[model samples]
Target: MTDHKEAITILGKTIHLGESKELSFEVAKLHTFNSVEVPVFIERAKKPGPTILLTAGIHGDEVNGVEIVRQIIEKGINKPKRGTIICIPVLNVFGFINLSREFPDGRDLNRVFPGTLKGSLASRVAYKLIQEIVQEVDFVMDFHTGGSGRFNAPQIRIIKGSKTLDQLATKFGAPFVLYSKNLNKSFRNTCHKLGKPILLFEGGKSFHIDNNVTIHGVNGIKRVLHSLGMLATKFKISTPKTDCVFINESKWIRAKYSGMFKATTPIGSFVTKGDFIGNITDPYGKFNHFVKADNTGYIINVNELPIVYQGDALFHISKELL
Candidate 1:
C-alpha cells in the first residue's frame, strides 16, 4: 500500500510542509470513551530504504527525550540518503497530559507490549504503538527517564545477547551502555524478539529537562543514524571506546527506619560491602541510624531527597565489572 510517489501522508491527506511534514496518528480509546490522536513527523527520501522509529514519552514525566526528538526534527539535519525516519515524540499522550508516570488506570505501558485488542487502557495503547510504528520499522530508539522517586546515570540499555545491538549501543556515544539482560515485556525486548535492534536512552529525572542530557541524546541518535547508512554525514571523530560492563545483579538500599535522612555518597562513587553510606537522624539528634552498603560496587544511583520512609529505596548499587 506504499507508493514512492506519495512520500508523505497524514490522516489520509498528502501534507506538504515545504521542508517540515506532520501526520495525525491515532491510539485506541480508553474505557471505550475516546481515542488518543498523536502527532508523527517524518523526513523521507525519494529512494526507499530502511525505516527508523524514534519514540519518547513512554513514561509521561520523561520530558527531556520529548524535547530532544522535537529539536532533532525541527533542526532538520542532513537529509536521509537511503531511507525514512519517523519520530513519535510523545507516545503516552494521556499520561503526558497529566505529567504522570502511568496511564490513567494506573497501568505501566512499557510493561505491556504487543498488546491485545480487547484489553486495558495501557494494553490498547501498546497494541496501537506496535501496530502503527513497530511493525513498519527497521530500527527503533525509545527514550526514557528515571522512574518514580529515582534518578539515573545517563546510559543506553541494549539486549545482551545480540552482536548487532551491542555495536549499535556503542554508536550511540553514551558514556554508559547498561546491558539489560532482564528482557521484561518492554518495548525494547519485544522489538529485539522481532529482530529489530532498539536502543533505550535513559537520562536525568522525571518532569524536568536537563539541557546537557538532551544535547547528548540528540547527538547520539544522529550518530547512530549515520552509522546505519540512513544519513550522509562525515565521521568527524571515532566514538569513545569504553568497555561495557555486564551488570547482571544489583540491589537497592532501603531505609531501616523512617526519619530525616542524609546521603554521604555521591552517584558513581565506589564502595565496599560494609561502607557507611548515609544516616537517619531524629529531629533532636536523639536517635540515629547509619545506612551502610551491603555489596561491593559503585553508587550508580541514589535518592536526591532527604526525607524518607521505612522500606524506601535510598540507593541503587551495581557493579559495572564483568
Candidate 2:
C-alpha cells in the first residue's frame, strides 16, 4: 500500500484516483500518414495499493493473451477496490495488424529489451514500453503462447531465484510452474534487472484462442490480485485439484525424418523414455517412421501441424521436480 497519492500519467493524460480510461500511445506512423498506437487500459482505485501491470500480445500472433486481457477488462477489473491495474491488450500494433509474430522489419519484439529511441521499429516500441510502462509497475504478468502449429499446456514460467515471483506464481495457480532462465533482451530479464517481479503465462497456440487457457489466465490474474490485497472483495478463487508440477529444465523432441506427421500423444501427457510420441508416414504411405520421447517427462508443448520436416521440433518435454 502506498501512502503518498499522486495521479498516474500516460500518453500525456493524467489519470486521477478512482478513474479509468482507455488511452493510446503513438508508436509509429503508416505510409498513409496514419498513426499506429499501442492501446493502454488503466484502472486506478480510490484506495492506495501496489500497482500491477498485465501485458499481452507481445507477439502479434498470440491472440489467447489478447483475448484474456480483453475478458478481464470486460468483467470490470478496471473498477478496482484498491491500487491500480494497467492492461495493455496489444503491444505490437504492427505485428497485430498484419497477424504476424514479429515487427514488419522481421525483428522479434520480445528479443529487444529496454529499447532505444533511435533504434528499429521494434526497438523503439520496446523502449517506449520500458520507459513509460514497465518502470512504474510493482508487479507484472506477461502472457504468451506457443508458436504457430504448436500448442502449449497452460503453465507459468517464473524466473529462477526470485521467491517473490515464485509466490506470486503459486498464488496465480497455474497447473504447471517452471523455473526458466531469463533470456537476454527479453522483457522478463529486463524487468528482473530493474528489481521487479514478473510472471509469464504460456499457453494455447499462436493465432488461436483456447477457451480453457483463456479462462485459466483470467482467473489466475484475479487470484494474484486478491493475493496482493489489491482486489476489493473476496471471490471464490479457482484452484485445480492436480498439484502444480515444478520443473527446472525442459527439452524438445525433434523430428527424425520429413513426412506427414500425426501425434499420438497430446499436450499435457506424461511419457517415458522411448515411448511413441507420434508417427511420420510418407505422403504415398510407402514408409513410416515413429517418433519417441528421449526422456521421461511431461509433454508441455506439441506440434499440431500435420506436415513435418527433419529436425522440426515436435514436442517440448519438461522434467518434473522430484
Candidate 3:
C-alpha cells in the first residue's frame, strides 16, 4: 500500500520496491480555479509483506485524528520494516481547509461509500479512494474524534462477533472497545464488504487535541505495526497502563431540561445508579438541578459544551460489558 510484487500503481504512478514517494490526486478546485490535490504518502519496504493504510480527517474538524497521522509521518513511523505503509493524513481536503465537519456541499464524507462516478463531490472522492487506494491495501486503520463538544475516551469500534477484530482491538490496547454495528454506506462497511480488515479509532473531541488521546492513538498504531513485524527496530513498544475493557452495549444520557450544564464526572470512570454526577443551572440566580447517573457503568463520553437543551446527549455510558 497489494496484490502485486516489486511495484504498485497509485494514481497512475508506479512505485517500485523500497522507493518512497509523495503522490497526490486531483479532487476539485477552489472558487479561484486553483487545483486542489489530496496528498498520499507511500513507503515500501525492501522485503515484501502485507500493506497497511492509515487514514484520518474524514471529518475536517477532527484535528486530533489528523495529528495522529501527522506524527506517524513526522516520526518516520510510516517506514515499515517488511511491508508497505500508506498514510493519508487528510482525506477530506475541502472540509479540512474550511475546518468544517462536512464537505463544501454539506455532505458527510463517511456516509458515502463505494461512490458513483458521476455523483456529488464527496461521493466522487469516496469512489476514487475505493478504486485507487482501498483496492491496494491489505488492511486499514481509520482515526476519528467525537463530534460537537463531546469528548470521548480512547476507544476502538468494531462490529460484534468478529474474533479477528477482537484480537486486533485487544492488540490496539485502547481504554475501551465498543462493539457496534456498521452504518450503511460507511467506509468501514464498504471495506469489510471487500474483505479488508479495518480498525476504527475514536477519541477526544473535534477542534481540540488532547495529549492522552494522541499518545494512545500513536501507541496503538505502533503496536499494530509491531504485531505485523513492520515496526522499525529502533521503535520500542510501550505496555498499556491498564487492561482494555470490552463494551457490549451502551446508552446515551440525555439532558432532562435545557440549561447551562456542567459534568462533575470524568470520562472513562464508573458510577453507581443515581449517583450525583453533574448539574444544570441558569445564567441568573435560578434553580440548580443535580444530574444523576443512569446506571452503574463506565462513562465513555462527556459533552463538554456549556449550553444544553432538552433531549441533548450529555454522556455515553456502557450498558453491558464483555
Candidate 4:
C-alpha cells in the first residue's frame, strides 16, 4: 500500500510528501547519561508509490551490512523516482558502539524481533523498530554478512516457493539465491508475519568490508529498486554478470581434526566429489589432513578462521538445486 496521503508520522515527527528528514529513535542512555539514538534516513518523491525499507547492522559487528546501506545513502541512490525510501544503517547502535554482536546485556538483537517495550534493552529496540519503522513500509531489503570467521559469497536469501519472493530474488541477481526458512523470533520472521515482503542479502563477514561484497550488495539493491520502479532516473541498473544459482538445500563441511586450517578452494567455486577443498594440520606439523569435498556443489561460505577444532564448520556447500 502506498502512503499517498498528506503526511506520514514516524518517531513522533510528521514528514510530508516529497520531504527528506533524518529522524532518530532513542531507546536508552549510557552509564554517564549520554543519550543514544539510531538514525533513520527518509526520502520521498511527490508522486504516490510504494515505500521500501533498506536496513542493516542488526548485529553490531556486521559492519559490512552497515557499509552497504551507508553507500546507498551517500551516493544519493536512495532518492527515489516515485515513492519513499527509508534507510536504517545501524540498528543495534549499542552493540555497534561496543564493537560486539549483541547488546550490552548479551542479547542478540536479531533474535528479539517485535520486542516488548519492557523487555531487555535489545527487545525494547526491536519493539521500537517494528512499531515506529517497519509498519510504515511496503517492502524490505535487510542486509547481512556471514558470522565472524566465515566469509559468505554474495547471495540473496528467501523462503522457498513464494513466486513473488522468487521473482524479487531473481531481480536482485546476486551470485546465489539461498532458500532458507525464516528463523523463529528473527526480524525476517516478524516482518513476514506482518505480511511484508523481505529479501535478505548476505555477503562477506562480520566486521570485515570486502569491495566485491559491497559492490554486489549495492548493485543488487539498485536492480531490486529498479524492478520496483523506485530507482531514480540518474541511476543505472545492469544485468548481473552471472545468473544466480538457486540452491534448494545445502550442508556445512566440518573439520575432522583439531588443528590449523586453510582453504585452498575459493568461495563460490564448484567442487566435485573428493575435490581438495582445504586442509588441517597441527601447529607442530606432526599431522596434516587434506579436506576434500563430499559431493558436487558450489561453495557458498568459507570459514576464514586460522584455527579450528574438530567438527567446526568450514565450508557450506550446496547439495540440491532448483
Off by over 4 Å in 4: 1-3
lDDT of 4 by residue, 1-322 (tens): 4556567777878877789999988969889999898889999888878889999999988999999999999999999997889999999888778778999888999999889989999999999899988888889999999996899999999998789899999999999999999999999999999999999999999889999999999999999889888899999998999998999999999998999999999999999989999999998978999999998999999999999999999999999998
lDDT of each: 0.75, 0.86, 0.92, 0.92
* Candidate 1 global CA lDDT score: 0.75
Which sections of candidate 3 miss by over 4 Å? 1-4
lDDT by residue for model 3 (152-242), tens: 9999999998888898899889999999999999999999999899999999999999999999999999998898889999999999999
lDDT (Cα, 0-100) at 299 in candidate 1 = 72
Tens digits of lDDT, candidate 2, 1-322: 3523567666667777788888887888989999987779999988877778889999999999999999988887645678888999999878888889999989999999878989999999989898877767788899999996999999999877877877888888888898888999999899989888889999999989999999889989888888877765745566775778888889999998999999999888889999998999998979999898999999999999899999999999986563
Q: Least accurate stretch of 10 residues (summed lDDT) in model 4?
A: 1-10
User: Candidate 1, which ten residues in sequence have the lowest lDDT sum?
Assistant: 1-10
Best-to-worst TM-score order: 4, 3, 2, 1
User: What TM-scores do the predictions have?
Assistant: 0.84, 0.95, 0.97, 0.98
Q: Flag regions of model 1 displaced more than 4 Å.
A: 1-21, 28-35, 182-184, 232-246
Whichever of 1 and 4 has more TM-score, that candidate is 4
TM-score of 2: 0.95
**Native RMSD of candidate 4 (Å):** 1.1
